[model samples]
Target: MGDEAGTANQGAPNAGVSKSVSVRELVNRLKLEVIVGEEALDRPIRRSKVHRPGLEFAGYYDFFPIEHVQVLGKKEITYLHKLTHQERDERIGNVVKYHPPCFVVTWNQDGLEYLTAHCRKEGIPLLRTPQTTTEFMMLADGYLMKQLAPEIQVHGVCVTVAGTGILLRGRSGIGKSETALALIRRGHRLVADDAVVLKKVNPQVLLGTHNGTTREFLALRSVGLMNVVRVYGRGAFQDETRIVLDIELVPWKENELYNDLQLEPQTSEYMGVRVPCIQIPLQPGRDVAALIEAAAHNWYLQTQGYSAADEFMRRLQQQ
Candidate 1:
């Protein structure tokens, strides 16, 4: 499906950069109630890790991550209630002095007058939610991770063949789009065409999606731009996919060697994550689309602990 809101921006300076999420965005996304410092909702959340200030409430502030969103649950609130007024004020005051992005009170825990007062004085956002501490932390952490993840723009075509995500990379006019269209006709789904936005969501996962305004649209040289959803229906498109394989197309050279056996696996790194890679030579008579489909199937087999090249070698040794 085409996403008008998720349109890719080719000229954006921050397209591939790590981004910060505003406390206002978080508040709206999580449906949190603004307890105090409504004006401070513009504060930026730079870290994805949520913190529970139990130690801070106990008057221990060593190695505190003030940039993280602080959470106050039943345990922390109960302990704070046990403390004297001066002790509670001093502890909360010490935390608010650092001016964290925000403080979120979870499980509808009340008795936050001290927290609200300190936050209002320091212009720090104080938010409340009905979700439990664990649930809220998980939701907030997941949202922050996706928003603050490192991303990069790649010039290629991304498609899902069978069940694997494949990225087609090559120079201009190398038939990347044409191959993707062919794959779509073969019951595959197109993730993105032209420019692909790759986000490193974690240490081991790189997500691929269409870059602004170009989602579900494919450019086929002489055929011009075609809306994939209009031509192939909704089943032929996907919003995003986890990239697992990269296949680079190059013009066939008579003297150059090619990996016909595919005995040695290749990999390409994007934003610090490496994905399985292969290079295919383009020729006038070669069916590049079918080759890509085969590659995808082979990738799936490898993931299932079956390698065709290894099997071929084992058979050869037996012969």
Candidate 2:
């Protein structure tokens, strides 16, 4: 039996997959200058939270998050300047002894002999950034969070119809790609064609993107694989979008009961995140693309506290 959400309880595939971003990746992506410890660029940054190490600099190390990337900003640098050389060396040593993934000095602050010495000795990567403390922290944290987020690859087509992100899921040769093509011709944007990578950005958000290699191509059963961007122009393709709905296309079965009225909500789970789902029965001469477009518009209305079903019921009662 299914749960109240109308989805069968199933284990999430690749839900517990461990993910990390290497210091080298961070440096290249963020354009950070490598000051020292180039040999340690392969160090893995598993945690998303970038540590400021303010307390550690003040000679307190209790409950320190040693696994995170340590960031030294303008405030921390100014604080170190007031301390004696010996005090600064001791405090910096105490923190670097843990051998955190890396150390980032923000705002291009100078006079880091003590910090660099310890980082070199411990073989911890020391990086420099021109952005301010808060700015760099936000960038690094966001990048790390996305890189380390739990992700699962789904065999489906993802598109944006009327600004709503929709994931079309069905078996092979079930017209998933064809419907997506139709939607694209109707001015909708295709995010991913064959394989959609869904990442759990947070508890309430699931972001979907295309598989890197196949992002620019779409496969149609009628025709062969075509480059969507080259054929349809760049406006019809999007790199990623927040998945708000899932549409499952199933073959029309004789004597099978289907929901005619979408009064109750249905959802499908991926990586512990539930997304609204609609199961559409496939039949001859059915305009599945039109149905999906309407569904996207209806979802937008529901978000604005307007339900067509409820309004219809009210009209019937008045009559």
How well does each candidate superpose onto the true structure, as a TM-score?
Answer: 0.87, 0.92
Best by TM-score: 2
Provide the overall lDDT of each model, using Cα atoms, as 2-decimal numbers. Answer: 0.85, 0.87
Query: Which residue pairs does candidate 2 place in steric collision?
Result: none
Please list the residue runs of candidate 2 whose C-alpha ends up more than 4 Å from where it truly belongs after superposition: 1-12, 15-17, 254-259
Candidate 1 Cα misplacement greater than 4 A, ranges: 1-18, 256-259
- Residue 72, model 1, lDDT: 88
The total of clashing pairs for model 1 equals 5
Native-structure RMSD, model 1: 5.5
